[model samples]
Target: MEHAIIIVVILTGLGAVFGLILAYANKKLALEVNPLIHVVEDVLPKGQCGACGFAGCMAYAEAVVTRPEVAPNLCIPGKDPVAKMVAELTGKAAEAVEPRIAQVRCAGSNEKATRGFKYAGVSDCVAANLMFGGDKTCKYGCLGLGTCASNCPFDAISMSEAGLPVIDPEKCTGCGKCETVCPKKVIAMMPLTARVRVNCNSRDKGQVARKACSSACIACTLCVRECPYQAVKVENNLAVVDPSVCVANNCTDAKCLAKCPTKAIRPAVLGIVPGAEDQAAVERACPSCIKTNTAAG
Candidate 1:
C-alpha cells in the first residue's frame, strides 16, 4: 500500500508539471485568429463552391480579412445583398457584378442525339467520358450521368428525362460547381442579362452535326450574318454568341433563332420561345443561305 501511494503521488506531480508546460507552450505557439475572418465567414453563403477562386468559404474569409486586393463582390452565390454586407465588413467599395447562372451548352438529348455505344461503366460523366469520348456520337455532348448534378452544392441541377441537366435559375447560386465538374465542358456560365444563346457546342461540320444530333449547331454562319450588332461568330464549326456585345447594343431581337436550320440558336432564358416575327427578318438577312438550306433539307 505504501509503494502504491508513492507511485500515485509521483505520477500526479508529473502530470501537473506537464500540464503547466503544455499551457505555456500553447500560449506561446498558438496562432492568433483575426476577428474579421470570423465576421467575413459569417457573412459568406457557406456554399464553398469556389466561385470566388478560393478553396472554400473559410479560405475566402481569411483572404478577404488579410488581403487588400480581394474583391468583396467575388461571392457570386451571395449576390448583391451579400456583396453589400461584405463591403461594409471590409470597408471597401462593392462593385456591381452582373449575376451569372449555369447553362447546359449541349442540346443533344437522348431522343435527338445518336449513341455510338452503350456506356455500362461508372455513372459519372468524367468516368463514362473515358471510353472514347462517351457513348454519345457527339463527342462534345453531355454524358448526362449526373456528375454535375451530384457536385452541385446548391442542388440547382437535375437530370431531365431526355438525359440532360436542367438548371433551376431560382435555386442556382451561380457558384460554378456544376460548370467545374462537367467533363464534356458542356456547362457554361451565362449572364442573366444574356438575350441570345447557342444551345449546341458541337464542332462537327453541318452534315456530320445533323447526323449526330438534330439540334446540333451546324456553324451555318446564318446567325453571324443575321446579328445586326455583330455579336455572333462561327468558330470551329460552332455558332458562338458574344453576350457582352449583344448587351452593349441592347440587341434583344431573336433573328438568329429563326435562321438556325437545326433550331440550335435560342433565347438565353429557359422555357421562353422567341417571337415568330423574327423569322421574317431572317429571310431578309440572308435569302440565298436560307434557299440553300431549304434545298438541302
Candidate 2:
C-alpha cells in the first residue's frame, strides 16, 4: 500500500509537470490567428456552401486574409453587404458580384409529374436515384423527398404540399447547397435580378416530356425563334436562358413566354407575387410585373 501511494504521488507530479509544459507550449508555439480573419469570418454567413471555393466561412476568411490573390467578393450568399464588410476588415477593395438565388428548374410537382411507381424505399434522393432513377416518370425530375432541404445549411428550402421544394429567396444566400444535393440536378442558381426562366429540366422528347409533366419544355425551339436577341435556345431537348445575351440587348419583351406552348417559361423575379387577375395579362405580355407565382402559390 505504501509503495502504491509513492507511485501514485510520482505519477501525479509527472502529470502536473507535463500539463504545465503543454499549456506553456500551447501559449508560446501556437500560431496566432489574425484578428482581421476573425472579423472577416464574423461578417460571413457561415453557410459552408462552398460558394467561396473554401471549406467554410472560417476557411474563406483565412484565405482572404492570408492570400493576396483571393478576392473578397467570392461569398455569393453574403452578397454586397458582406462583401463590403469583409473587404473593409481585410483592407481590400470589394469587387461587384451579382447576387444569385436558388431556383427549382423542374416544375414537376407531385400534382404535375407523373409517377412511375410509389417510392417505398429510403427517403434520401441519392438513394432513391440509385433505384431506377426515382419514382417520377420524368427521370430527370426532382425526387421531392426533401434531400435538398435536408442538406441546406440555411433554412431557405421547404418541402411544399405540392411535393416540390420551395426556396425562400429572402432566407436563401444562394449558397448552392440545394443545387449540389439534388440528385436530379433540377436545382440551379439564377441571378437574383433575373426576370425570366425556363422552369423545366427534362431532356425527353416533346411527347414523352409532355406526357410526364404538363409543364415540361417540349424543346420545340419556339423560344429560340421568338427570342429577338437569341437569348433563349433549345439545347439537349431543353430551353436554356442566357442572361448575358438578354441583358446586353435589354430584351424585356419576353416573347419566349408566349411562344412556349407548354407554358414552361416563367417570370423569375424573386419576391413579387402575381395576382390571379394579372395571370392572363402576364401570360400574354410576359412582363416583369409577373413573378414565378407558380412555386410560391
Candidate 3:
C-alpha cells in the first residue's frame, strides 16, 4: 500500500508539471483565428486545386490576409465576379480583373503533324515526355498526357476526340494550373477579352517549323508587317502578339492571313471552315492528333 501510494503521487506530480508548462506555453504563444480569413475563404471556390499557387484554400486565405495586394479573389476558377465580391467585402479597389483563358500554344494536331511512332507507355504526358521527348515529330509539341485535364478540379477541360486538351472557355477559371503542369509549356493564359491569339508555339525557323507541323508558325512576319498598329513582332523565331497593342481585326491586314504559308495564325473566334466537322477524330496524344481526314488520305 505504501509503494502504491508513492507511485500515485509521482504520476500526479508529473501531470501537474506538464499541465503548468502547457498552460504557460499556450499563454505565451497563443494564436487567435482571424475573422478576415473566414471572410476571404468564404468568397473562394472550394476546388482546392492549388491553381492560385497555394496548397489549398485555407493557405491562400492566410496569405491574402497578410498581404492585401495579393487580391483575395485572384482565384481563376472563381472568375472575375467572385473577385469583385471579395474586393467589395474587403473594402479594397475592385480594379476589374481582366478575365483570362487557357490557350494551347502547340498547333500540331495529328493531322497537322505526323507521328514518329505510336506511344504505348504510361498514360501521363509528363511520363511520355521523358521517353524520346514525345511521340510527335515536333520536339516541343504538347505531350497530350491529359495532365491539364486531370488537374482541372472544375472539369473545364476535355481531351479532344483527337487527344489534344480542349478547355471550355466557359468552364476555365484561368487558375494557371494547366500552364504550370504542361511539360512542354504549350499551355498559357490569354486574356478572355483579347480577340486574336497565335495558336502555335513552335520557335523553330520557318522552314523547320513547316516540316515538323503543318500549322506551326514560321515567323514569316507577315502578321507583324500587316498589323497597321505594329502590334506583332518576330521574337526568337516566334511571332508574338502583344495583346496590349493588338487592335481587333486590324491585326490582320487584307494580305497577312492569306500570306501565312502554314495557316497558323487564327482569329480567336475563327469560324470553323465551312463544312469542317466538329466531329473530327480525336487523337490520344496532343502531337499525334491528326484529323480523321488524315486517316482517309
Candidate 4:
C-alpha cells in the first residue's frame, strides 16, 4: 500500500514537472502574432470569398500586415472603401480598384436553348455535366442548374423563371464566386463601365450554334464589320468585344448591336435579362442609335 502511494506521488510529481516544462517552452517559443492582423481582418467584408487570391480574409489580413510586398487593395468585395481602409492601415499606396460585376455570357434560356435530354440526377452543374455535358444541346452554355447561384456568397445570383441565372449587379461585388463555380465558364467578370458584350460562349460553327440555341452567336462577323472602332472581332465562332478599345475610341454608337443577326452581341448595361426584345427596344432609343439613324438617313 505504501509503495503504491509512493508510485502515485512520483508519477504526479513527474507529470507536474512535464507540464511546467511545456508551459515554459510554449511561452518562449510561441510566435507573436501582430495585433494588426486582427484589426485588418475586422475591416474586411469577412466573405472569405478568396477574391483577393488568398485562402480567406484572415490569411489576407495576415499577408497584408506581415508582407510589405502584398498589395492592400486586393479585397474586391469591399471596393474602394475597404481598399482605402486597408491602405491606410498598412501604409501602402492605394490603387483605385476598378469596379466590376459578374456577367452570364450565355443568353440560352429554357425556351431558347434546345435540350438534348432531361437531367434527372443531381441538381449540381458539375454532376450534370459529367453525364454527356449536361441536358442542354449547347455544350458551352450555362447548365441552368443553379450551381453558380447556390455557390455565390453575396446572393448576387438567382435562377430566373426561364431556368437561367440572373445576376444582380448591385449586389455582385465581383468576387467571382459564381464565375468560379460555373462548370461551363459561362459566368464572367466584367468592368462596370463596359458598355457592350457578346452574350454567347459557344465555339461551335454558325449553323450548329444556332441549332443549339436560337440566341447563340453565329459568328456572322456583322458585329466586327459594323463596329466603327474595330472593337469587335469574330474568334473561334464567337464575337468578342474589346471594351477598352471601345472606351478609348468613345464608340457609344454600338452599331454592332443593330447588325448582329442573332442579337448575341448586346449592350452590357442591360442586367442579365433573358429576353433580347426589351434590350433591342432600349438600344434603339439610346442617343447613339438616334445619331446612327440620322447619319445613315
Query: Which candidate wins on TM-score?
Result: 4
Give lDDT for model 2.
0.82
Cα lDDT tens digits, model 4, 160-272, are 88888888877899999888888899989989777787788999999999999999999889878877788888889999888889889877567888757787877775455
lDDT of 1 by residue, 91-185 (tens): 98998978988878888888889999999998999999888999999998888899998999998888888888888888898888888888888
Displacement of the residue 234 alpha carbon in candidate 2, Å: 1.3
Per-residue alpha-carbon lDDT of model 2 for 1-297, expressed as tens digits?
999999999999999999999999999999978888888888888788898889998999999999989999999988899889888877899989887888888778777789988889988999999999998999998888999989888888888777777888789888888888788998898886665877789999999999999889998998888777878878899999987777777766677776567778877744322111135545545653245344444
Q: Rank the candidates by lDDT, best first.
A: 4, 1, 2, 3
Error of 3 at 54 (Å): 3.2
Where is model 3 more than 4 Å wrong at Cα?
1-30, 248-255, 270-297
Ten contiguous residues minimizing lDDT sum, candidate 2: 269-278
lDDT of each: 0.83, 0.82, 0.71, 0.87
Q: Model 1, stretches more than 4 Å misplaced?
A: 1-20, 271-297
lDDT of 3 at 247: 47
On the 0 to 100 scale, the lDDT of residue 196 in model 4 is 82
**Candidate number with greatest lDDT:** 4
- Return the clash pairs for model 2, or none: none
| Candidate 4 lDDT for residue 266 | 72
By TM-score, the better pick of 1 and 3 is 1
Clashes of each: 0, 0, 11, 0
